[model samples]
Target chain A: MDVFLQTLVAGILKGGLYALIGIGMTLIMGVMGIINLAHGQLMMVAMYITYVLHLAGVDPYISLFVAMPALFLLGCLIQRFLLNPLLKVDTILPENQVLMTVGIGMVLTEIIRFIFKSDYKSVSTGYSNATFFLGNISFSIALGISFIIAIAFTVAMFFFLIKTDIGRSIRATAQDKDAAVLMGVNTGRITIITFGLGSGLVAAAGCLLAPVYYVFPDIGGPFTARAFIITILGGLGSTVGAIFGGVTLGLAESFGATYISMDYENIIGMTIFVLVLLFLPGGFKRLTKI
Target chain B: MLKVDAIDVFYGDLQVLWGSSFEVREKEIVVLVGANGAGKSTTLKTISGLLRPKAGTIVFDGVRLDRLPADRIIGHGVVHVPEARRLFREMSVEENMVMGSLAPEARKKRRETLAWVYELFPRMKERRKQAAGTLSGGEQQMCAIGRGLMALPRLLMFDEPSLGLAPILVEDVFNIVKRINKEGVTVLLVEQNVRQTLALCDRAYVLENGSVVLQGTGKELLADPHVKEAYLGL
Candidate 1:
C-alpha cells in the first residue's frame, strides 16, 4: 500500500512537468492549427541552452530568462521564414505537415548535436535531490518547484489570453483568421508571436526538466511522443485539458507500472490514447471552461 | 472619403471585379446591392485590403490605399465589419471590441472609442462580459459592428450587417447605420436586401457577375427598370 501511494505521488509530480511541456504544444496546435513536429527539438535546444548556462555557473532558474526569450525569437523567425510559407495553401498533402516538421526537427537535432555533442547532461541544482514528506508519500523539491512554476505559467497564460488586447487578437486569429484580418488584426504577426510564445514556454519546460530527465541531442524523440500523447488526450487547442490529461496519464502510468510489468507501461499508455481517440475524438471537450 | 476608382480584382484566373468605380463621400452612406455572387462582398474585401486588386487602385482621403495590408488599411480610417458577424466567438464581447483597436495608433484612442461603441450598442454594454458566441444573432451583429466602431473608423464598411437578423432587427441595424453616419462616420454598406439598402443610402451601385451594371442616386437606382426587375422584385 505504501509503495502504491509512493508511486502515485511520484506520478502526480511527474504529471505536472508533463503539463508544463504539453501546454506549449497544445496552445500552438489549438490556436494556430499547426502541428509543430519541431516542438520536441525546440525543447531539446532549450535543454542544451540550460546545460550551457549551468556550465557557465548560472542557476537553471536564472537561465530561464535567457532561454525563454532566445527560444521565443527563434520560434518567431522559424514561423516567419520556414513554417509561414508552408502554412499558406497546401504545398504538402494533409499528413505532410508532420513529415515536413519531422525533417526540420532532424536538421535542428543534428545542428545541436554537432555544436554540443550527444553526451548526457543534467543540471545539478542546489536542491536537486532534497525532498519533503507528507505521511508515507515523498515529493522532491525540484518536482514541487516544477509543479508550482507550471501552474503559475499556465495561469499567467490564461490571464493574458482573457485579459489583454493583444491576447484577444491571438484568440480571434486562432478562431477565424480571415475575420480577424478583416477587423484589422495583423494575423501574420499574430502567427509569428504565437509561435514565439509557444517555444518560449517550451524553453522554461526544458530548464525545469534538465535537472530530472537525462538530456541528449536525440532525447527529444521520447519527449515528443509523450507531448503528442498528452496533447491528443487533452484535446487539441485546450490548455486546461492538457493539464487534466497529463495528470490522468501520469497516474495511469504509475499504477500500470506497479500492478503490471513495468516494461508494458508504454503499451498501457498507448492503449489509453487509442481508446480516447476512438471514443472521444474531441478529447475532453466537456471539461473545457469555454 | 473612400474612392475605389476603376479597380479590377481577380481571384487567380477568374476576374472578380471589373472597372468597379464607386465613391463614398465623408459622412454619407453608400450602398452596394447585388445577388450572392455579384461581387459586393469582394469589393468590400478589396477595399479593406483582404484582396488586392490586380489592376487599378483604392484611395481614401485623397491618399492611395492599394498597397497597404488589411490591418494597416484600418489606420487610414477604413474599417470592414465583415459578413456573418465574425465576432471572436469564444471571447467575451468586450475583448472582441478591444481587438478591433489593435493598431499601435488606435490603442491610444481605445478608451474613448470603446465608450462610443458601448454608447452605440447599449445592449452590448449589458452583455460585455458574456461570450459573443452565445449572443443572439441580432446581438452578435451589433457586437460585430460595435467592434468596428471601436477602431474609430472615418469610413466604416459593413458587408451584409442585415444578414441572419429578424426584419425588426434589420430595421434597427439600418437605423443605427444612419445614426452612425449622422455621427460623422462614412458608411459603405453591401447587402442582398435591396429594398432596405436602397431605403438607407444616398447613392447606390448595382453589381452583377463582378461588374457594376448600374449606378445612380438611391431613388434613381430604386426606380431603374433592371434594378426594379432583378433586385427590387417589383
Candidate 2:
C-alpha cells in the first residue's frame, strides 16, 4: 500500500509540471487553431538558456527570470514574422502552417545542436537530488518545489484569463473570430501576444524541469511528441482538458514504470492515448465545457 | 453616415460582389434583402472590413474604411451582430456581453451600456450567469443583439438575425430590431424574409447575384413589379 501511495504521489507531482507544459501548448492550439510543433523545441531553448546561466553561477530557479522573457520574445517573433504571414497565403491545404511549425522545430533543434552540441549536460544543483521522507514514502524536494510553482502559475493563468480584458479578448478570439473582430479585438496583435505567452509558459516548464532532467538538443523531440499527445488527449484548445490530460498521462507513465517493463513506459502512454481516441474522441473538452 | 460606393469583392478566385453600392444615412434602418448566395452577408462583411474590396471605396463619415482591418473598422463605431448567434459557448452570457465592450471607448461606458442592454433584453439579464450555448434559440439571438448593443455602435448591422427560429419568434426578433432603431441607433440589416423586412425598414437595397439591382424606400420597392415578381412572388 505504501509502495502504491509512493508511486501515486510521484505521479501527481510530476503531473503538475506536465500540466504546465500542456497548458502552454493547449493555449496556443486553442487561440491559433494550429499546433506549435516547436513547442518542446522552445522549451529546450529555455532549458539551454537556464543551463548557460547555471554555468555563470546562476541558480536554475533564478535563471527563470531570464529564460522566460527571452523565450517570450522569441515566440512573439515566430508568430509575427513566421506564422502570422501565413494567414494571407491562401494555401490549398491548411496543414501547410502546421508543417511550417515542424520545419521550425527542426531548425530550432539544429541551431541548438550547433551551439550546445549533442552532449547531455546535467543541471545538477545542491537541492536537485535532495529528498525527504514522509512515513514510508519519499518525495524529491526539487519536484515538490516545481509542483508548487506549476500550480501557482496555473492558478495565476486562470485568473489572467478570467479577470483581464486582454484575456477575455484571447478567449473571444478563440471562440468566434468574427465576433471578436466586430468587438474591436486586434486579433493580429492577440495572436502575437498569445504566442509569446505560450512560449513563456513552456519556458517556465523547461526551467522547472532543468534541475530534475538532463538538457540535450534531442531531449526536445520526445517532449514535443508528449506535448501533442497531451493536447490530443485533452482537447484541441481546452485548458481544463490539458490539465486532466497531463495528470492522467503522468499517472499512467508512473504506474507503467513501476509495474510494467520500464521499456514499455511510452507504449503504456500510447495505448491509453489510443483508447481515449477510440472511446473519448473529443477528450476532456467534451466533458468540461470550459 | 455610411457610404459603400461601387465596391467589388472576390473570395480568392471567385467574384462574390460586383460593384455593390449602398448608403445608410444616420438614424435610418436600411435592409439588404436577397436569397441565399446573393451576397447579403458578403456586403455586411465587406463593409465591416472582413474582406477587402477589389475596386471602389467604402467611406464612413468622410473617412475611407475599405483599407482598414476588421477590428479597426469597429473602432469607427460599426458593430456587426453576425448570423447563427456566434456567442462564446463556454463563456457565461454576461461574459459574452462583456466581450462586446472591450474597446477603451466602449469599456468606459460598459456599466451603463450593460444596464441598458439588460433592460432591453430581460431574458439576457435573467440568464446572464448561464453559458450562452445553453440558451434557447430566440434568447441567444436577443443575447447576441444585447452584446452588439454593449459595443455602443453608432451604426449597427445585423446578418440574418431571425434564421432558424420559430415563426412567432421571428416577428419578435424583427420587432426588437425596429425597437432598437426607434431608440436612435442606425441599423443595416440583412435578411431573406423580404415581406417583413421590407415593411420594417425605412429603405432597402435589393441584391441579386452580387449586384445591387434595385434600391428605394421600403414601400417603393414593395410596390415595384420586379420585386413583387422575383422576391415577393406576387
Candidate 3:
C-alpha cells in the first residue's frame, strides 16, 4: 500500500511537467488555430539551452529567467515574419497547417542536432534527489518545485488572457480576427505577442523538465504527443482543463504500471485517447465557440 | 464630417463598388439603403478602412484614410461595427466590451467608458459575467454597439444592424441608434430595412450596383417615385 501511494505521488509530480508542456501547446493551438508540430522542437531547444547553461555552472532554475524571454522573442519573430502571412491564408484545413508545422519541427530539430548532436543531456542540480515528507507521502523536492511553478505559470497566463489590455486582444483575435481588427485590435501585433508568450511557456516547461528527464534533440516528440492527448482531453485552449487532464493522465499511467506490466504504459495511454475520441464527440462542448 | 469620394472597389475581377460617393456631415445619422449585392456594406467597409478603394479616397475630418490600416483608422475616430454582431463569443460580456476599447483613447479611459457602456446596455451589465455567445440576438447587437461606443469614435458606422432582429427589437435598436447619434456621435448606418432607416436618418443615400444613384434629405428620398415604388412597398 505504501509503495502504491509512493508511485501515485511520483506520477502526480510528473504530471505537473506534462501539464506545463501541454498548456503551452493548448494556448498556441487554441488561439491561433494552428497545431504547432514545432512545439515539441521548441521545448527540446529550451531543454538544450537549460542543459548548456547548467553545464556552464548556472542553476537550472535560474536558467528559466534567461531561457523564457529568449524563446519568447524568437517566437514573436517567427509569428511576425512567418505565420502572419499565413493568417491571410485559410486554416480550416488542419492538414495544410499540420504539414507546415511538421516541416518547421523537422527544420528546428535538425538545426539543434547539427549543433548539439543527438546525445542525451540532463541538468543535475544540487538538490536533484532531494525530497520532503507530508504525512506518509514522500514528495521529491524537484518535482514539487516544478508542479508549483507550473501552476504559477498557468495562473499568470490566465490573468494575462483575462485582465490586461494585450491579453484581451489575444483572446479577441483568437475568437475572430476580422472582428478583432474591426474593433481596432492590431491582430498582427497580437499574433506576434501570443506566439511569443506561448513559446516562452514552452521554454519554461523545458527548463523544469531538464532536471527530471533525459534531454535530446528528439525528446520533444513523445512530450508533444502527450500534450496533444492532454489538450484534446481537457478541451483545447482551456488553461484549467490542461492541468486537470495532466493530473488524470499521470494517475492513469501510475495505476497502469503497478497493476499491469510497466511496458503497457504507452498502450494504456493510447487506449484512453482512442476511447475519448470515440465517446466524447466534441470534448467540452459547453465551451463557447469563438 | 466624412466623405467617401467616387471610390471603386473590387472582389477579385468583379467590381463591388463603382464610383460610389456620399458624405456625412458631423453628428448626422446618414443611412445607405440598397438591395442585396448593392454594395451598401462594402461602401461602409471602404469608408471604415476594412477594404481600400482601388480608385478613390476616404476623407474623415479632412484626413485621407486610404493609406491607414483598419485598426489605425480608429485613431482618426472612425470605427466599424460589422454586420452579424461580431462580439467575441468565447469571452464574457465584460471581456468583449473591454476589447472594444482596444484603441488608444479607449484604453486610456477604459474605466469610464466601461461603466458608460454597462449603463447603456443594462442587460449586458446583468450578464457581465456571462459568455457573449449565450446572449440573445438583441443583446448581442447591444454589445456590438456598446463596444463601438467604447472606442470613443467620432464617426460610428453600423452595418446591417437590423439584420435577423425581430420587428419589435428592430424598433428598439433603431431608437438606440438615434439616441447614440443624439449623444453627439456621427453615425453612418447601412441597412436593408429602407423604410425604418429612412424614418430615423437625417439624410439618405440610395446605392445601386455599387454607386449612389440618389441623395437627399430622408423625407425627400422617401418621397421619390423610384424609392416609393421599389423599396417602401407602397
Candidate 4:
C-alpha cells in the first residue's frame, strides 16, 4: 500500500508538468485546427535557453520568465510569417500547414544540434537531489516545486481564458473563426497571440524540467510523440482533457515501470491510446463538454 | 450607408456572385430574398468582407470595405450574423455575447448592451450560463442575433436568420429584426422565406443565379407577376 501510494504521488507530480506541455499544444491545435508538430521542438529550444541561462548563474525558475516571453515572440513570428500565409496558398494538400510544422521541427532540431553539438546536457541546482518526507513516502523537492508551479500556471491560464477579453477572443476564434470575425474579433491577431501563448506555456514546462531532465536536440522527437499521445488520449483541442490525459499517461507509465518492465511503459501508453480511440473517440471532451 | 458596386465573388475557380450590386441606406431594413444557391448568403458574406470581390468595391460610408479583411470590417460597424447560428459552441451564452463587444466603445457599454440583448431575448438570459452548442435550433438563432446586437452594429447583416426554425420562432425572428431596425440600426437580411421577409423589409432585392433580377419596395416585389410565380407561389 505504501509503495502504491508513493507511486501515485510521484505520477501526479510528473503529470502536472506534462499537463503544461499538453495545454500549449492543445491551445495551438484548438485555434488553428492543425497539429503543431514543432511543439516539443519549441520546448527543446526553451530548455536550451534555460540550460544556457543556468550556466550563467541564473536559476531555472528565474529563467522561466525570460524563456516564456522569448519563445512567445518567436511563436508569434512563426505563425504570422509561416503558418498564416499558408491559408492563402493553393497547396496540393490542405495539410500543408501541418507538414510545415514538421519542417519547422526539423529546422529547430538541426539549429540546436549545430549550436549545442548534439551533446546531452543537464542542469543541476543545489536542491536537485533534495527530498522531503511525509508519512512513509518521500518526494523530490524540485519535482514538488515544479508541480506546484505548474499548477499555479495552469490556474492562471484558466483564469486568463475565462476572464480576459483576449482569452475570450481566443476561445471564440477557436470555436468559430467566421463567427468570431463577425463578432469583431481580429482573428488573425488572435491566432498569432494564441500561438504565442501556446509556445510560452511549453517553455514553462521546458524550464521546469530542465533541472531534472537531459537537454538535447533529439529529445524533442520523443516528447513530441508523447505530447501527441496525450493530446489524442485527452481528445484533440480539449485543454481540460489534456490534464486528464497527462495524468492518465503519467500514472500508466509509473505503474507500468514499477509493476511490469521499464520497456513496457511506452507500450502501456500505446494501449491506453488505442483504448481511448476505440471507446471514447472524442476523448474526455465528449464527456466533459468544456 | 453601404454600396456594393458590380462585385464578382468566387469560391476557388467557381464564380458565385456575378456583378451583384445593391445599396442599403441608414436605418432601412433591406431584404435579399432568393432561391437556394441564388447567392444571397454570398452577397452578405461579401458585404461583410468574408469573401472579397474579384473586380468590384464595397464602400460603406465612403470606406472601401472590400479592401479590408473580415475582422477589420467589423470594426467599421458592419457585423455579419452568420448562417447556422455559428455561436462559439464551447462558450456560454453570455460569453458569446461578450465576444461580440470587442470594439473599444462596445466594450465600455458591454454591460448595458448585454442587458438590452437579454431584454430582447429573455430565453437567452435564462440560459446565459449554458454552453451555446447545447441550445435548440430556434434558441441558437436567438442567441446568434443577441450576440450580433452586442456588437452595437451600425449596419447589421443577418444571413438566413430564419433558416431552420418553427413558424412561431420565425415570426419572433422577424419581429426582433423589426424591433432592432426601429432602434436606429440599418439591417440587411438574407432569407428564403420570401413572403414574410418581403412583408417585413422596407425594400427587397431578388437574386437569381448570382445576379440581381429584381429590386423594389416590399409591396412592389410582393405584387410583381414574375416574383409572384417564381417565389411567392401565388
Candidate 5:
C-alpha cells in the first residue's frame, strides 16, 4: 500500500508536467488542424536554451521567461515562413504539412546536434535531488514546484481561452476557418499566434523538466511521440482532455516502471494509446464535451 | 453602396462566374435570384473577398475590394452571412456573435450591435449560452444572421439564407431581412427562392449560368416574361 501510494504521488507530479506539453500540442492541433511533428523539437530547443542560461549562472526557473518568449517567436517564424506557404502549394496529399513538420523535426534535431554534439546534459539546481515526505509518500522538490507551476499555467490558459477576445478568435478559427475569416478574424495571423502560444506552453514544460530530466539533441523524438499519444488519448483538440490524457499516461508509465519493468515504460503508454484508439476513438474529449 | 463590375471568377480553371456585373445602391434591398449553378453564391463570395476576381473590379463606396483578402473585406463593413449558416459549432451563440465583431472597428460598437442583434432575434438572446451546433436549423440561421449583424455592417450580404427552412421560417427570415434593411443597412441577398425574394427586394438581378441575364426594379422583373419563365416557373 505504501509503495502504491508513493507511486501514485510521483505519477501525479509527473502528469502535471506532461499536461503542459500535451496542452501545447493540442492547441496547435486544434487551430492549425495539423499535428506538429516538431512539437518535441521545440521543447528540445527550449531545454537547450534553459541549459545555456543555467550554465551562465541563471536559475532554471528564471530562464522560463526567456525560453518561453524565445520559443514563441521561433514558433511564429516556423508557422509564417515554413508552414503558411505550404497552404498555397498544390499537393495531391493533404498531409503535406504533416510531412513538412516531420522534415522540420529532423532539421531541428540535426541543427541542435551540430551545435551541442548530442551529449546527454542536465541542469543541477540546488533542489534537483531534494525530496520531502508527506505521510508515506516522498515527493521530489523540483517535481512539486513544477506541478504547482503547471497547474497555474493551465488555469491561466483556461481563463485566456474563455475570457479574452484573441483567445475566442483562436477558438473560432479552430471551429470554422471560413466563418472565422468572414468574421474578420485575420485567421492567417491567428494561426501564427496559436503556434507561438503552443510553443510557449511547451517551453514552460521543458524549462520545468530541465532540472529533473537529462537533455540531449536526440531527446526530442521520444517526447514528440509522447506528446502525440497524449493528444490522441485526450481527443484531438480538447484542452481538458489533454490534461486527463497526460495524467493517465503519467500514471500508466509510473505503474509500469514500478511493477513491470522500466524498459517497458514506453510500451505501456503505447498499449494504452492503442486501446484508446480502438475503444474511445474521440478520446477523453468525447467524454468531457468541453 | 456596392458595385461588382464585370468580374470573372474561376475554381481551378472551371469558371464559376463570367463577367458578372451588378450594383447595390445605399439603403436598398437588392436580391440576386438564380438557380443552383447560376453563380449567385459565387457573386457574393467574390464581393466578400473569399475568392478573388480573375478580371474586373469590385468597388464598395468607391474603394476597390477585389485585391483584399477575405478578412480585410469585413473591415469595410461588408459582412457575409454565408450559405449553410457557418456558425462556429463548438462555440456558444454569444461567442459566435462576439466573433462577428472581431474587427477593431466592429469591436468598438460590439455592445451596441449585440443589443440590436438581440432585439432583432430575441430567440438568439435566449440561446446565447447554448452551443450553436445544438440549435435547430431555423435557430442556426437566426444565429448566423445575428452574428453578421454584430459586425455593424454598412453592407450586409446573405447567401441563400432561406435554402433549407420551412415556409413559415422562410417568411420570418425575409421579414427580418426587410427589417434589417429598414434599419439603414444596405442588403445584398442571393437566393433561389425567386418569387418571394423579388417581392421583398427593391431591385433584383436575374443570373443564369454565371452571368447576369436581366436587371430591373423588383416589380418590373417580377412582371418580366423571361424572369417568370426561367425562375418563377410561371
Candidate 6:
C-alpha cells in the first residue's frame, strides 16, 4: 500500500507537467484542425534555451519567462509564414499540412544537432535531487514546484478562455470558422495568436523539465509521440480532457515502471493508447461533454 | 443601404452568380426569393465577403465592400446570419451572443444591444446559459437572430431563416423578422418560402439560375402571371 501511494504521488506530479505540454498541442489542434508534428521540437528548443541560460548562471525557473516569449514569437512566425500560406495551395491531400510539420520537426532536430552535437545535456540546481516526505510518500522538490506552477497556469488559462474577449474569439473560431468571421473575429490573426500561446505553454513545460530530464537534439521524437497520445486520449480538442489524459498516462507509466520491467514503460503507454482508441473513440471528452 | 452591382462569383471554375445585381434601400425589408441552386445563399455570402466576387463590386452604404475581408465587413455593420443558424455548438447561448459583439464598434455598445436582443427574443434570455447545440430548432433560429442583433448591424441579412421549422414556428420567425425591421434595421432576406416572404417584404427580387429575372414591389410580383406559374404553382 505504501509503495502504491508513493507511485501515485510521483505520477500526479509528473502528470501536471504532461498536462502543460498536452494543452499546447490541443490548443493548436482545436483552432487549426491540424496535428502539429513539430510540437515536441518546439519544447526541445525551449529546453536547450533553458539549459544555456542555466549555464550562464540564471536559474531554470527564471529562464521560463525568456524561453516562453521567445518561443511565442517563433510560433507566430511559423504559423504566419509557413502554415497560413498553405491554406491557399492546391493540394490533393489535406494531410499536406501534417506532412509539412513532420518536415519542420526534422529540420528543427537537424539544426539543434548542428549546434549542440547531440550531447545529452541537463541542468542541475540545488533542489534537483531534494525530496520531502508526506506520511509514507516522498516528493521531489523540483517536481512539486513544477506541479504547483502547472496548476496555476491551467487555472489562468481557464479564466482567459472564459472571461476575456480574445479568448472567446478563439473558442468561436474553433467552433465554426464561417460563423466566427460573421461575428467579426479576425480568424487569421487568431490562428497566429493561438499558435503563439500554444508554443508559450509548451516552453513553460520544457523549462520545468530541464532539471529533471536530459536535453538532446533527438529527444523531441519520443516526447512528440507522448504528446500525441495524450491529445488523442483526452479527445483531440478538449482542454479539460487533455488534463485527464495526461494524468492517466503519467499514472500508467509510473505503475508500469515500478511493477513491470522498466524497459516496457513506453510499451505500457502504447497499450493504453490502443485500448482507449478501441473503447472510447471520442476519448474522455465524449464522456465529459466539455 | 446595400448595393450589389452586376457581380459574378465563382467557386473555382463553376460560376455561382452571373451578372447578379440588386439593391436594398435604407430601412427597407427586401426579400430575395429563389429555389435551391438559384444562388440565393451565394448572393448573401458574396455581400458578406465570405466569397469574393469574380467581377463587379458590392457597396454597403457609401463604402466599397468587395475588397474587404469577411471579418472586416462585419465591422462596417453588415452582419450575415448564415443558413442553418451555425451557432457555436459548444458555447452557451449568451457566449454566442457575446461573440457577435466582438468588433470594436459593437463592443462598446454590447450591453445595451444585448438587452435589446433579449427583449426581442425572451426565449433566448431563458436559455442564455444553455449550450446552443442543445436548443430546439426554433430556439436556435431565435438565438441566431439575437446574435446578429448584438452586432448592432445597420444592414442585417438572413439566409433561409425559417428553413426547417414547423409552420407555427415559421410564423413566429417571420413575425420576429418583421419586428426587427420595424426597429430601423435594413433587412435583406433570402428565402424559399415565397408567399409569406413576399407578403411581409416591401420589395422583392426573383432569382433564377443565378441571375435576377424580375424585380418590383412585393404586391406587383405577387400578381405577376409568370411568378404565379413558376413559383406559386397557380
Q: What is the TM-score of chain A, computed separately for every candidate?
A: 0.93, 0.98, 0.91, 0.98, 0.99, 0.99
> What TM-score would every model get versus the actual structure?
0.95, 0.97, 0.95, 0.97, 0.98, 0.99
> Candidate 6's residue-wise lDDT over A167-206, tens digit each?
9999899999999988888999999999999999988999
After superposition, candidate 4 runs with Cα above 4 Å error: none
In model 1, residue pairs whose N, Cα or C atoms come closer than 3 Å (at least 3 residues apart or on different chains), thus clashing, are: A30-A237
Q: What is the lDDT of residue A267 in candidate 2?
A: 89
Candidate 1 structure lDDT: 0.85
Clashing pairs in model 6, backbone N/Cα/C closer than 3 A: none
* lDDT (Cα, 0-100) at B10 in candidate 2: 97
lDDT string, candidate 1, A241-290, tens digits: 88877787888887889889798777777888899899987777555754
Q: Please, what are the lDDT tens digits per residue for candidate 1 over residues B114-196?
A: 88888888899999999999999999999999888888888999999988889999999999999999998889999998997
Model 1 residue A276 CA deviation (Å) reads: 1.0
Candidate structures ordered by TM-score, highest first: 6, 5, 4, 2, 1, 3
lDDT of each: 0.85, 0.91, 0.84, 0.91, 0.93, 0.93
Tens digits of per-residue lDDT, candidate 3, A26-105, equal: 77876788777788788888888898899899988899998999899988887777767765786676466567668877
Model 6 per-residue lDDT at A78: 88
Candidate 5 root-mean-square deviation in Å? 1.1
DockQ-based class of model 3? medium
Candidate maximizing DockQ: 6
Residue-level error in angstroms, candidate 4, position A172? 1.2
Candidate 5: give the clashing pairs: none
Enumerate the candidates' DockQ scores in order.
Answer: 0.73, 0.79, 0.80, 0.82, 0.86, 0.91
What's the lDDT for residue B220 in model 5? 100
State chain A's TM-score for model 6: 0.99
Angstrom error of the Cα, residue B70, model 4: value is 1.1
Clashes of each: 1, 0, 0, 0, 0, 0
Q: Per-residue CA lDDT of candidate 6, range B1-234, in tens?
A: 788999999999999899999999999999999888999999999999889998998998789999898889988989999999999999999999999898888899999999988888888999999999999999999999999999898999999999999999999999999998899999999999999999999999999999999999999999999999989999
For candidate 2, write residues B1-234 as lDDT tens digits: 999999889998899999989999999999999889999998888988888899989999988998888888777788899889889887999999999898788899999999999999988889999999899999999989999988888899999999999999999999999898989899999999999999999999999999999999999999999999999999
Between prediction 2 and prediction 5, the one with superior DockQ is 5
Residue-wise C-alpha lDDT for candidate 4, range B98-214, written one tens digit per residue = 988888878899999999999988999999999999999999998988888888899999999888899998998899999999999999999999999998899989999999999
Poorest lDDT segment (10 consecutive residues) of candidate 2 chain A: A88-97
